[model samples]
Target: MALLAPPKDWYHPAAGAERLWIGIALVWCFVMSLMMPYWHFRGKQNANGTTYTVTPKDYLERTEKFVAANKVGDLNGIPIVQPAPGTDIYLLGRMWNWYPVLKLQKGETYRLHISSMDLQHGFSLQPVNMNFQVVPGYDHVLTLTPTSSGEFTIVCNEFCGIGHSTMIGKMLVE
Candidate 1:
């Protein structure tokens, strides 16, 4: 078909509306490119890139000790811990569960450390919509200060395993 053949003036320069649209598209692309670094420097909610290498065994031990020291009760089989404000707290993701539901005080900041035991997972806090990746060999720390007092749910956004749909956790802010 004629549509499949080369244009009559294939070597001609683009002009008029075609040139104007091309220039506009280039400007739009440059603006978008600038916005990425602008937001990276200005955004408050971005990840602070604070991660440390940690073995799964060592991380599990630390979590166990933390639970033992601050555990207030047990839900199902998971320990429910109310850690003191301004202290460090641990949340471990493994298999199909998030160990030790955490309770925190509103407006008090805590260094929240998250990691995995077996496979990779996700830490997604609902309503507030903060998300972080949970890797097995690295600890991800988030300086968190819950502004409101309520119960929040944490669901694994990463497809972890067969029971990943059941990998739900809870956080209580008081």
Candidate 2:
């Protein structure tokens, strides 16, 4: 037991190499801290630091009504909502579907309101590589401006349920 006992002088001096590593880590941490405020002020950044003012039910009803009034028909079995520029657009995420494929114009910005109906889903826009986590209660609003005119696919990158792989949506910029 004495052979395994700890040394009385436990405070050993660290090498210069170890001190250099600690100094580098402290500097790196300070630089990363500035990114928080930078992203918060810049609206162009894709960051979710918002809260839902209304419940999911209320949000869903609003989306449903919007879809009903502004329905432009279906694209590949998904309902298409052609909203004007600067208008608030809703994209609901459910068990295995993303309702109402959105249609927007290029070079124009639009407010995209996204949420979930049942469970959390993934709101991913292809070609541009934009992705957002769709929560049930929180309504995440994303301001998007399509620079290119084409048909882009929306993929459900988050695994929600058994049929998650088939959960696909569409977005058209014209």
Q: lDDT tens string, model 1, 1-174?
A: 566988777787899999999999999999999988888889656577479999999999999999999999987788999999999999999989898899999999999999999999999998799899999999998888898889888999998889999999998899
Highest lDDT model number: 1
Q: Model 2: runs farther than 4 Å from truth?
A: 1-6, 12-15, 53-56
Q: Report the poorest 10 consecutive residues by lDDT, candidate 2.
A: 43-52
State the lDDT at 2 in candidate 2. Answer: 69
lDDT for model 1, on a 0 to 1 scale? 0.92
Candidate 2 structure quality by residue, lDDT tens digits, 1-174: 467867878777766989899889989998899778877787466565355666888998999998987789898787898998999889898888888888899999888899988888988888888888888888888777888889988899888989999998888889
TM per candidate comes to: 0.85, 0.82
Off by over 4 Å in 1: 1-9
- What TM-score, to 2 decimals, does candidate 2 have? 0.82
lDDT of each structure? 0.92, 0.85
